[model samples]
Target: MSIGAVLAQLRGDFPDVTISKIRFLEAEGLVQPGRTPSGYRQFAAADVERLRFVLAAQRDHYLPLKVIKEQLDAADSGAGPTAALPRPPRRLVPIDAPAENVGLPVADDFTVGKELRLTREELLEQAGIDAPALAELQQYGLVRPGPAGFFDPDAVLVARTVKAMTEFGIEPRHLRAFRAAADREVGLLEQIVTPVYRHRDPEAKSRADEVVRELAALSVTLHTLLVKAGIRGVAGC
Candidate 1:
């Protein structure tokens, strides 16, 4: 079967599947189709099945390609079945619904855990972004590495989110307002915490930290609600 035949076979199940997406999966080494002497892709039945597995894992399970690849590799090695893949632990909740413990904010919620550091290649793979996309994100200040030249988990999240946003025709330059808004919000939060943070008493400093965490949570909630309201108005909901 040619690549086009493979696409036709999967398109009924995955309406959004495209030749480009299939090519990308091949580039990521998730699928290995044979190439003819003319350099045209020659997909086998197993290759089509593998593409289905990858697409279904992404759509139904929200598994990253890296994890999906690992599962595929494990399956190929006869280690385990891909059906044993893990699902996200948390319940899927509606956007309008308040999450559990919305009022209680913990320090862990505000801090990156374990001081994780990833190289550029790792960040790209985890974030599912290419170098040019990453560069554009950095150009817009939407994603940045630390002074030590390593990216944190937050950078990965930002790059991934921006990549998804691009599907709706949103570009990096269009996200500048988001960066500006975040900076302004952080500045305002700082103003409220600076005095408490400066107290000579250690207890005051601790209290300031707690306050910042709580306020950070509230700020995010407020922003989400405001955006929801505005979107509803726009949608006449």
Candidate 2:
């Protein structure tokens, strides 16, 4: 089943289910659809059933994805598909713990929640930026959120940096190059890790994560040294 077929099958009930939303849920580890050599998503009937469970959990039970994902994970491991699952409380969304991604480790201590959760209003206030400014940052691909509608801590840092740059008259448009460069770096990294991630081995996933962290650290170091060298050229010292 192609992604389009899955969308068509689900969208009658889940009208807001866009392709990106499905991809976001995949990123959250909700469903594992196979991908083609050309990177097209291929959903199976089981994937559709899982997607339905997620939608029903959110819409009928009013459960946050975190809680729903836990139940799903339990079921996937041994609880028997959709059997003997605990009923979720019909309540507002709670503060979420950090999610373990394919390679991400446990959350580190940060002033903001270690999971990097922030509502839009909270991010604006903390970053000392306005809504429009934040919107511009997102528009320029400098920041983004998951489908769960929470910004990561990096988004707040980006907002703060952009705000400070505004003092020097640097605007979001001028930051497009930064976004482009970051995208290129990510593309290269993805090529290196995609095969490891596709493997179903726990150790492979761990190795992939280590590769990600080391490469990311190296990239940052290179960026910092280049910036320093550029500044020295202006200082002439």
Candidate 3:
């Protein structure tokens, strides 16, 4: 079908999509459109399906374009969809064996664990996040455990973040700033996604997800670079 017709159908599902966004995805090599003899764009059924998959993954996984590119690369290599799967498990080795005796496990051989919901206590124990950290996060509204005293999937993520911060010598009180910073960051992200929310189109949703992932990665990279640069300047001074 013509690009306009296909895009119209897509817009029915995701309203905020723009020609620019589709062009941007094309520039990123995420989607390739065919050209008619008249130079108008033509998209086939498979192209629409591929676009749907790309959008779904971006929305759901928040994967960066580089990561998505790697996944597509794997597919191109005839490795099947297994290469797109999550990281695999470490191989079991006997502790008593010599260092040279152990063989590394294949990178592709990994297990996908079931999603586990943890209670407050279970989350603390499993994630090694202290009580004070949990309390601090709660105070900052970074997370809320369910009424059943169990943490949803997001709480597990919070628990992991708390654990990592502690390892970095960040005290619970010091971490409160992160909660505020996160709130501000989320506010910005919401504004960015508003267009997608308003349109409710599949392609717009996909574009929203792609934008979010790219923004997040760029945020992290820029934040880390600036922080390190500041630290170096201070040390040199």
lDDT of each: 0.78, 0.73, 0.63
lDDT of 2 at 69: 85
lDDT of 2 by residue, 1-237 (tens): 998899988755654457887888899999999988998888998898888888666555445567778888888888747554333333122223122211222111111335868999989999998889989999998889879999877888899999999899999989999999989987987898899889997756755665665556456546765886798899996
Residue 54's lDDT in candidate 3 = 57
Estimate TM-scores for all models.
0.55, 0.51, 0.45
Tens-digit lDDT string for candidate 1 (150-180): 9988898899898899999999999999999
**Best candidate, lDDT:** 1
Residue-wise C-alpha lDDT for candidate 3, range 1-237, written one tens digit per residue:
776776765554433345665677778997788999998888887667656555545544655566676776677678758433332122123334445433332111221246567777887786677788778778867677767667776677776876677788976567667678767876887888777757856656655666665555445445555776799899995
Which candidate do you rate higher for lDDT, 1 or 2?
1
Candidate 2, poorest ten consecutive residues by summed lDDT = 101-110
Q: Model 1: what TM-score?
A: 0.55
Q: What is the lDDT for 161 in model 1?
A: 90
The pairs that clash in candidate 2 are none
